[model samples]
Target: MMVFTKYLEDFLMKCSTIGRNSATGRLAIGVGHESYESSHLQPSQWYGEVRELCGLANRPCTFPCTNNLSPSEAAEALNDHIASICQQLPPLDTTRLPAYLPARLIAPTVSQFQVLQKLEKTRVKRGTIPLDLPMHLIKEFAMELATPLTSIINASLQQSKCPSQWKTVFVTAIGKTQSPSSFGELRPIAITPLPSLLCESFATDWAYQDLAPSVDRRHFGNMRSSSTTHCLVSFLDFVLTHLDKRKSSVTSIFIDFKKAFDLVDHITVISKAAASMGIRECLFP
Candidate 1:
C-alpha cells in the first residue's frame, strides 16, 4: 500500500510527457487482443491505464481510513499521528548566542555564478520536490533566473529566515509490504519545496568542511561513498575476519527502531552542527 498527495499525479503527468509518448490513445495490446488508435479517444479517458503502463501509481492505496472516515477526518488523523511521533523542535532562540560560537552565524552569501553553477548540474539532481514550483521550468530559466535567485538566497541568509512557503511539504506514506494495516507500517517521506532544498544544500556545504573530521568511520548512512550495501559488505568482512582469520566466535544482534527518523532532535543537531563550524546564531526561524 502507498499513499501519495494529489500533487504526485500532476508531477507524474509532467514527468511522463517529457520525451515520451504518454498519449493514452497509443495504448495497445500485444497478441490476439484489441488495439486503440490515437485519434479514437481522449488521453484523459485512459489516464489510469496509461499510468499503469508507465509503472506509475502501481500501489493505488485507498487508505484504510477510507473505511469509516471522511477526507478531512483521515487527514486530521494522519496529521495527528505524525505529529505525535515527529518531535518538532521548540521555537528558535533568537535572544542570545552560545558563548563558544560566533555572535552572528548567518548563512553565507551566494553569488549569481554560484547559483548558475549549481543549476548547471541540474541533470544530476538526485531528488525532486513535490507541490512546489516545477523543477523543469526552473531548469529552463536557470540562466535568466540565477541573479534574482542569488539575491533572494543572500537576503534569506542575511536575515536568518526562510520564506514561509518553503515550510509547506507533502508527505507520501509508503507501506513496507503489500498490505499495511496500520500507520506504523507506513514510512512517511516528506517532499519539500525546491528553494528550501536548494538552501539546505548550500547550508550543508557550509558545515561540510568542518564536519568531516568529526564524522565516525563506522557511520555508514550519510557519508560520501557509504551506503547500505557498503555497510553489509563491511559487516560480512568483519565476521569473516573474526571467525576465520582471528579464530573467534561471531555474534551479533540487530535492533529495529519504530519510526526512528520521526523522533530526531533536529534542532539540537543543527545547533551542534552550526557550533562545530564556529557559527553561534540561530538560522532557523
Candidate 2:
C-alpha cells in the first residue's frame, strides 16, 4: 500500500509538471492574442506579486497560478489533500451488504483489499461506477474482515462460481429535460458493486491493452481514453475543412445503435476479437 502511494505521488508529480508546462504555453498564446487595450496587463507584472502577498507564492500553490510550486511539493500537497478529504467522509458499512445482495457475497479479504487498492491507483475512466469509495475506508474495511472474506471468495472460485449477489446491478434513468415522458429524453445508467467493478477493471485493462492495437481503429467503442463521438466529429471537421479549401464534394453516412449494449452478445464479440488478432487462446482462459 505504501509502495502504491509512493508510485501515485511520483506519477502525480510528473503529471503536474506536464500540466504546468501546457498551461504556461496556453497562457502565452492567450496573452499574445489579446487586444491592444489589454496589452498593458502583463501576467508577469502582477501574478507573482499577488501570489506572494497571499502566502500562496510558496512552491506548490494549491490554486492554478503562474508562480507554481515544484513538482514534488505539488504532488505532496495533492496527496495530503486527498488523504484529508477521505478521512472526513463516512466509512463503508461492511456489516451488511446492500439489499437483495446474495448471501454468498462476502466481505473483502486483506489480499483482495490490496488488489482493489492497487487497481484504484490505476487510471480511472469517466462514467464507470457511480459510488465514490475512499481509499482509506477501503483499506480499513479490508483489514477488519480479511480472513473470512478471503475464505469465502476462494471457496466460491474453486467451485467455478461467483456470488449471484455480486452480479446484481441497480440502474437509474436520468431525464434530458426535454419533456417528461419522451422515449429519447431519458438516459439509463447502471450502477454496480465497487468490488465487482474493481475486479472487472483489472481483467479488462489486461485484455483491452493487449488487443487494442490489433483491433480496427475505427471501432472506437471500449477503447481507453478514446471517444467514438469525438472521433466522428474530428473526421467530419477534417472533411469539411478540405472540402471548403478545394471545393470538392464528399458524402457521409451516420449510424446510430439504439440500446447497443442490450443487443450485443459480449461472449461472441470477445471470441471474434481473439480470432481477429490471430490468437488461439480463449480470452477468458
Candidate 3:
C-alpha cells in the first residue's frame, strides 16, 4: 500500500511537471482517450507517452523540419505568408443594392437540453479540435459540461459578442509533396475550437432556415444533395436541351480568381451576415 501511494505521488508530480496548460483532464481516472489497450499499461508505461505529447502542441509547424526554427520564428513565418495572401478587396457598395423587405430571422431558442443533445452527439474523432483545449474532455464530461456551455452560447447569441478564442483558429500545414520545401507547397487547414465550431453550426442552421427563401435554387454548392459534379451535369443537360431546340451557338466563359477568399472584404461579409440576421452595425458573434 505504501509503495503504491508513493508511486501515485511520483506519477502526479511528473504529470504536473508537463508543460501543458491543462493537465487535469489528461490525468483522469479512466485511461487516455486513444485506445483501450493503453488502459492496462502502468503509469510508468504511459509517462513517456504523455511526456512526448506535452510540448507537441507548442511545436513549431514549419515545413521541412530541418529548418529547426524556434516556435516564435515559425509563427512569424506563418504570419508573413498569411499576410501575403490577404489581398485587400474593395468593400461592397450598399447604395447600388436592390431594396428588399425587412425580414426578421427568429432563431430557435437554445436550451440546456439542446446543448446536451449536441454534446452527446459529438464524436471524439472530429478532425478539428479547439485551438488550445482538448475536445474529448468536454465530450467525456458532457452531462457536467452541458449547462455551462448552454449558458455561454445563449449569452453570446443574446449579446452578439463572440469570445475572441471562438473567433481565433490555428492553421496546420500539410505537405502536398514528398518533401515540402516552401510554405506555398503546404496546404493550410484551419482548426477552430470545438465550442466555436458548434456555435457556428447553430448559427448556420438558424440563418439558413430564415434565409433559404432569399437564396437562389440554382446556387447548389454546399447545400444538401448537391455537388460540383451535380451542377456540371445539370448545366450540360440544359445545354443539350437548348441545342435540341436549335438555338444559336452557346457561349460559356469561366473565370477563376487566385486566393479569392483571402481577397474578400471580411467587414462586408460580417455586415451582410448581420443585416440578414436583422441586426445592423454590430457583426454576428
Index of the highest-lDDT prediction: 1
Ranked by lDDT, the better of candidates 2 and 3 is 3
Model 3 scores worst on lDDT over the 10 consecutive residues at: 98-107
Ranking by TM-score: 1, 3, 2
Q: What residue runs in model 3 are displaced by over 4 Å at the alpha carbon?
A: 1-72, 87-108, 128-136, 176-182, 270-285
Number of clashing residue pairs, candidate 3? 0
Candidate 2, clashing residue pairs? 59-69, 60-69
Q: Every model's Cα RMSD, please? A: 8.7, 17.1, 15.0
Stretches of candidate 2 exceeding 4 Å from the true structure: 1-116, 119-136, 142-160, 182-185, 228-233, 241-247, 278-285
lDDT against the true structure, each candidate: 0.66, 0.50, 0.65
Model 1: runs farther than 4 Å from truth?
A: 1-62, 87-106, 123-131, 274-285
Writing each residue's lDDT as its tens digit, candidate 3 over 1-285 gives 456545655775675556235423334333346432234444454554443444222343446843788888987887678767774555456554433324243334588888888877877776765353455776778888878888888778767678987887778777776567877777778878877877777777766665676677888877867899888988998888777775556678888976667778866766665556444232233
Query: How does candidate 1 score on lDDT?
Result: 0.66
Better of 1 and 3 by lDDT: 1
Ranking by lDDT: 1, 3, 2
Measured with C-alpha atoms, the lDDT of residue 216 in candidate 2 is: 77
Clash number by candidate, in order: 0, 2, 0
Q: How far is candidate 2 from the true structure (C-alpha RMSD, Å)?
A: 17.1
